[model samples]
Target: MDLRHFRYFVAVAEALSFARAARNLNMSQPPLSKRIADLETELGVRLFDRTSKKVNLTTAGEAFLPKARDAVRAFDAALRTARLLSPSHSRRLRIALPAETSRNVLSDIVSRLQQERVQVHLVEASTADQQDLLTAGEIDIGVIRLPVEKQGLWASASLGQPLGVVMAAEHPLATVAKLRLCDLDPYTLVIFQRRFAPGLYDEVLDLCRAGGYVPHRILHATRMTKALLRTESAVAIVAERLAKRSGEAGSKEFIWKPLEGSPLHWWSSVICRANECVGLTRVAVDVILASLQQHEGWVPMPRSVRAQSEDIRPIEQRVDSVNAH
Candidate 1:
């Protein structure tokens, strides 16, 4: 009927002696005997055959023994699992990001968290999809690009490396120290589809329009490397870190260059729900912002746009500290 009753029943069932079961349970023989008598009465079955010298289990007691053991085991297992999954027990953060962004920054964040014994579940999706997942509660925080205008969402200052262009090594533009969007007008271009990278893709299109040429025969690919390898005539623009990882040879042949215009950079920020802000998110954001500051030549996002995300509130007034790092 109760957990204590089950425990008492198991002890008596195993030992086959009221005196031994009471001693094991640290209770007196009289109380233990009475409790077992009450349980048998409640169940409407006899549990033991007792004589002055010996005690043995009745058929009803034997039948209930395995069931009682199973109940105790199941309850204990459920308790253990709940403890393991508790936020305090795990101390891990569940984060989501676009694959490209994760490739650039997630590893470093994970390594830092590991030192603190915090585990991180890093899930990868397209930039837009990651945002949707973040909103849907599928992930706690997301690494996403700038100019994200969703309400109830907040973003930290740019976390890690900025985005750069990837072009084939043999391309004439690769010869330049740095290339601009204007410089790529003569060549066809390959880029991530608008669905995956609406903000960055639109920026590229706008820059091309300013240069007076539309991107010709633009090929859409889900993955950046696929877009690069599939297009021989078109130069693929990709994140700088991805360019470095893709290599110059093998399936994809490409080169990388920094866009020439002043402050020509694509950026990523850590995003989370404004209302859900908590200690873990703050700790993670601090670690990432610190890493960003340590790297040379990294700049914070502009004040106007940065002010929109709740994540910047704490760090906004501390600009000197951010830049000094």
Candidate 2:
């Protein structure tokens, strides 16, 4: 028989009722019954035991049920691969890299994908915007800061990115060996808008309060530039990787000082739709992780933050055309 025979057999086997299976399959019982009979004839066995009152699987049906289920699953996976991706979007992964993420991290990821002959289209988004884009299927994956609301998504293990303070070199605190959060109590805090990372935003404030620094005023800016980053009246608490790119760091007019105790351990992760991640999508994720391994300022994600709902497969288990191109 063909896939249809297996499909019909599985439906009948799972329901254990010819009439119920036929109704669920949207067909009349006669054809469904005949198809099951034909399958039994082709296999040279009686696959089911039928009586007036109820239905049950015979020994042969019980033996064949698992095989039939596997066949159905394989067929559906193949169908999704062939039909779900539009022609224009095929093999071209649309990705969102948030503003806080280092551009070089993305560049390295693209380089790895190129080695495997996969193309990429990139957009700069905040972690918050990336969340919306991923839900809408407008993009396949995103590199964002955690903690994300974990529903309908799968995420890679996080890499910890340490945070530090950036201010003008002439600022009073710049001379200290290591700065504490509380030391900046006199100055305003220049930070990213809360919308960029809602969870991180609230977490940072709590951390400041815990550290004994509660700013009287906070300035929220969407983009961090040299003009805003190294202001004398405020200090920006950001990742050192990001601070170096603010255009003033190279001039030596801005200094980045590590926060004592490393209190702000920013976490980064790659996320994608749980149900839709497969084939090339998985390959892309593996490649991205491999690329991140080449950079600094990343450590393994803590066990506590990983979502319990999805299995985050080990890199070796994921399929990637690492050698085949």
Best by lDDT: 2
Predicted candidate 1 versus true structure: per-residue lDDT over 1-325, tens digit per residue: 6877887898899888899888756689998898898899999999899999988999999999999877765665576457546877458677775664433355667877787777788888766776656544556677676545565566665633454566666667768886767676777777677877576577657656775546766777645554454355567665565665556333345666766653345656767766554566657666666554453234565533432442233232332242211
Candidate 1 has its poorest 10 consecutive residues by lDDT at: 316-325
List the lowest-lDDT window of 10 residues for candidate 2: 308-317
Decoy 2 TM-score against native: 0.65
lDDT of 2 by residue, 1-325 (tens): 8999998998899889998798757699999999999999999999999999888899999999999888876776566466456675566788888765566778887887777677799889878778767654568888777666645667766767788888887888878986898998988788888877887787778888889889898888746545665554578887776667765455578888888898887766777877666777778876776666556467664524233222233211223323322
- Residue 227 of model 2 has an lDDT of 63
Report, for every candidate in turn, its global Cα lDDT versus the true structure.
Answer: 0.64, 0.74
Superposed by TM-score, candidate 1 places the C-alpha of residue 155 at a distance from the truth, in angstroms, of 1.2
- Each model's TM-score? 0.58, 0.65
Candidate 2, residue 102: Cα displacement in angstroms equals 3.5
Q: In each prediction, how many residue pairs overlap at the backbone (N, C-alpha, C within less than 3 A)?
A: 2, 0
